[model samples]
Target: MSRIQCPRCQRPQSHCLCPLIPCLDSRTRVLLLQHPSEVNHALNTARLAALGLNNAELIVGEVFEDLPRLLNQPGYRARLLFPADDAQPIQTYGASDEPLLLVVPDGTWRKARKILHLNPLLAALPRVTLADGGVSRYRLRKAPGPGALSTVEAIVQALQVLEAPVSFEPLLRPFEALIEGQIAAMGEETFRRNHAGK
Candidate 1:
């Protein structure tokens, strides 16, 4: 029989980490523009990030037609989380009554670019990139570019800068759980050998 998968986190029953998900109330609105191909990827962190945050939303598509409407709503400023040459560091944006709408594209660099190009609203949004942090802890997938970050890491860093630092660390609980579980399953010797670079 096939293993039962948890619909929420999409991990198998024994490996499910939903119970560790954090409940965070964010002042900013986070919307994940995910590639359809990333939906079932074992290493995908966008869904987990969304699940942890109360104000987060996940939309799977290459071209989101409603993006413009969402942006035009009152009392919110929209910014795309991407590294364009013109993108300013996210830390520069201080607190405000105008809530922030952070649109993060979750996929390969090429796919993310496709999403940006296909949607004029996405392309036109002000771009903001995260501050440089340590290397990624994701051993299951490869990052696509210089200074790349996992989707979850990006969200955490953004929350730390935009919200409170304490507000985002709780979300890392399940993320660490996922990594630990995978390491155990892979065995010490194999995990050490494979993760030498991480």
Candidate 2:
């Protein structure tokens, strides 16, 4: 039989990561546009990110029919959190400046691009990229390249940058625990052989 899972975090009851998840608040709202394929993946980091933040939402689909309404959050300017040649670096905001509605595409590089391809309005938003040198802690998958990060890690880094002096580290606790759990399940020898160095 399948193991019982927590309704919230989706991990099996014995290994539920809800306790480690935080409900941190952020000035910058996060909107995770996840591809359907990622919803059932073992490491659904985008779901974790959505749960950890008070100002976040996770929507799973390819073509978002309500794109206009979704991006029309008041008192915030929406920006796509994807790297591009013309993408602007996310920066700390002043007290009086309007905060960002950070719309992130949660999927593999190709899937994320496909989401953009299907939703032109989402793709047309002002783009924002994280600063360089961030690395992925997600060991089970081969990263697309250096500086690649899991969805949660990218959100953490982006929040840290946009809300300077405020730490988003708490949001990473559940993610870290999840990684450890995955590594343990796979056995140290296997992890060392396959994912440790990359």
Candidate 3:
């Protein structure tokens, strides 16, 4: 049997394309507040998103404990990148904004609820949700709806929204290569079998 691990989480190198992690160069900083449970999961997109951004920080813990300090970090105009629900619209940052995009990746619905229940600090920061509808690239995890987006995609969208000229295409390219590596390591049948049920 081939011994490979998921590229993203590096868990025994399963059929995970996470190793195809992308690196991005942008002015806007990204801070990923990941749930501790997702740290090693093959399908966790927050980890992948962190790899893509140059100014990104991945903190694994409960949101309440982990996010406040990062927000208090020097020189970051922090904003929570959640969905643009009717109840909350995108709060605008200044033209000369020192932007920080805080991404919560425990899946969309769970993340939304997490912020609602645990993150009082997050509420105080500017909130910006995506209005342009799209689907998530994280096939291993199910989204809350059709418009739900993956962490990487969400970052790309956020960058675009800020008019930052960061190249997201390069970030996506590695994902396919990683997927191919995963398939090669696991054999197509086994890989498909394992992922199909999820």
Task: Please provide, for model 1 over 49-106, each residue's C-alpha lDDT reduced to its tens digit, 9 standing for 90 to 100.
Answer: 9999999899998878787686665667888898889998876345554768888999
Tell me the whole-model lDDT of each prediction, alpha carbons only: 0.82, 0.94, 0.62
TM-score of each: 0.90, 0.98, 0.71
> Where does candidate 1 stray beyond 4 Å?
92-97, 142-146
lDDT by residue (tens digit), candidate 2, 1-198: 899999999989999999899989999989999999999999999999999999999999999999999999999999999999999998999879899999999999999999999999998999999989988878788888877999999999999999989999999999989899999999999999998887
lDDT tens readout by residue for model 3, 1-198: 857765545646544444456556776777777767667654456666677777787777665565666777677666677654432443335677665655444544665557546777776565677765675555544565776776667766667656544356666655545555556767878867776545
- Candidate 1 has its poorest 10 consecutive residues by lDDT at 90-99
Worst 10 residues of 3 by lDDT: 83-92
- Model 2 segments more than 4 A misplaced: none
Find the candidate with the highest lDDT and give its number: 2
Summing lDDT over every window of 10 consecutive residues in candidate 2, give the lowest-scoring window: 135-144
Q: Is candidate 1 or candidate 2 better by TM-score?
A: 2
Off by over 4 Å in 3: 1-19, 63-66, 84-95, 101-105, 139-142, 177-198
Q: Pick the candidate with the highest TM-score.
A: 2
Q: Could you tell which candidate, 2 or 3, scores higher by lDDT?
A: 2
Error of 2 at 59 (Å): 0.6
Residue 112 alpha-carbon offset, candidate 3, angstroms: 4.7
